[model samples]
Target: MTVHEVHFPVRFEASVEDQPGPLWKARFDRYWPAYRTWFLRTATVGRPTYLDCRRAMRQHMPELVPVWESLVDLAGGGDVEARFLSLWCPPPYIGGCTQAVWLDPTGHEEPALLRNYDYAPALLEGNWVATRWLGPRVVAMSDCLWGALDGINEAGLACSLSFGGRAVSGQGFGVPLVLRYVLEMATTTREAVRMLERLPVSTTYSITMLDRQADWATVFVAPDRKAEVVRQAVVTNHQRDIEWPEHAKATRSVERQSWLAARVAQPGSAQDIAMALMSPPMVQDAYQRGYGTLYTASYRPRSGAIGLLWPGSEPWMQSVADFKEGQRDIVFPPPPAAVGST
Candidate 1:
């Protein structure tokens, strides 16, 4: 198998108020075209009104109101609907993540989370930013959307996500924003589960949450606004059973779930688990455009520490207590050339 390396440059910014004005501007300019295209295409029919989304956020996650308002201001008060749609509209189903939670049954070691975020190859070349929200002191990764794909909060809560192997879409918020809400508001896996249960997600998604107390839950949320909590340590794209037949047939969820289950059943140290995330079945190859393992992140909630790894670089570790604001560039293996392209 060929290995394709992709480089991601990390940028750290203080609270929403402190982020560079130009930063938001550049992001908006680059992604607005794509965002508009996606919105027009997916939300043409059965789309939720702006008022509906606002009401849902206020009713379920009032804490994010101020955050959203701040984002609106940063967006220069233009295309307000577009901004809200980014958070409310259902994005195209992007899958291919393998996440697991390892709890020390003896309580002698800290619990850890391992995950590989896979998506379209175009996203790999996009400007992905990792911001540390000063208001809540949360560190998270996001793209053009102002939602978090994964993050760890100062409260020692860590959260990550995978596309639920389903084709259903509904009248709820995007899962990425929901993940951002959990990291900012919840302090334990139990609390996170509560928020997941309450908030309505527009699509099916699997969220794996771990906290400092070694408590964890993998919740499968459907578009119908129902959520099921799994106590097991491993989760892939699918729920307990494949609810979406077409999606199941298209993805390798069965194989990946089995691979993760077999690996977690064995007794291993934290390093062993982390290593497993960087290898096959977990770390995916570039099978299609924008569909490969972008990066693997390991979070230790007990210490509020996070380590990031890619195809080549050594693991980089940072903790909330000792985080320094700066930027670092990561270079990844280039994608394979197209069949007939020069």
Candidate 2:
């Protein structure tokens, strides 16, 4: 295991802006080639599903239209809407993550979120970014795909997502986009739950949200557009109960869930919990294979602060009071081998 100290700079933009400017353009351009390859291979084949998701976005959250349009203009024009829609309806991809919310826990000074995002090792290199969308003033960490994986808003609403442990794909939006929508629009756990319920998702996902009021909910969403809310404090990849047999057999969802439940049952401070996530049962170590724990993020909604840590620097903390102040790059450990090399 190795670690590198890098800064994560956040960019702010308003919806009224015609374009995302040159920096954003460069980032988008760098990601476009790979994105286009993925889009053509997966989403383009499901045209109707893509259009349906597009319609759903238009109907359910029209306010986001301007942002999509801005992305299109930034792309220098070419069916960017379709490409954006493709992100909302991505091809099936397997991911592992563990997330939990601590509400009013003893010795826990404030409400906090503990999360570890495990994915392809290559992604840890450059695709991940943190941004503060000025239009709605949301501070979030996202990928080259332009959808938020986790974030908090100025209103003290924070949320994160975990794979729902189901492989079924349907006609709906991606979880990341839905997360972005919630952070951008909702101010409370109830409002975030409502958005999760109303939105049509193309895959299975569990979204855990926390607010400054100490309210939290883990909403389990399916490909069929069915959503059920579980008011539990911990969540892994699967729902409370697994419905997909193959998915259940394949993922460590149940094991991770049990591990989290037991850890939270004992009294611990926020730091203790966050540190626990950096170890076994939480921190996965298959970096060369692309299923390793890339980063762990702790969001403190009450104080509007974020702390980030990776494999080697668990005891040390990198605190960001405001994500909009300056630019920083979070230097990452070199990939174990060339990505996908056998």
Over the stretch 59-83, how does candidate 2's per-residue lDDT look in tens digits? 8778777767676776775664455
CA-lDDT, candidates in order: 0.70, 0.68
- Candidate 1 per-residue lDDT, tens place, 228-284, comes to 998868887788788776655455678878887887878877767777776665666
lDDT value, candidate 2, whole model: 0.68
TM-score each candidate. Answer: 0.84, 0.83
- Show model 1 residue runs off by greater than 4 Å: 1-22, 43-46, 80-86, 105-108, 124-134, 326-342
Candidate 2 lDDT score at position 336: 34
- The superposed Cα distance between candidate 1 and the true structure at residue 189, in angstroms, equals 1.1
Q: State the local distance difference test value for candidate 1.
A: 0.70
- Name the candidate that leads on TM-score: 1
RMSD of each: 4.9, 5.8
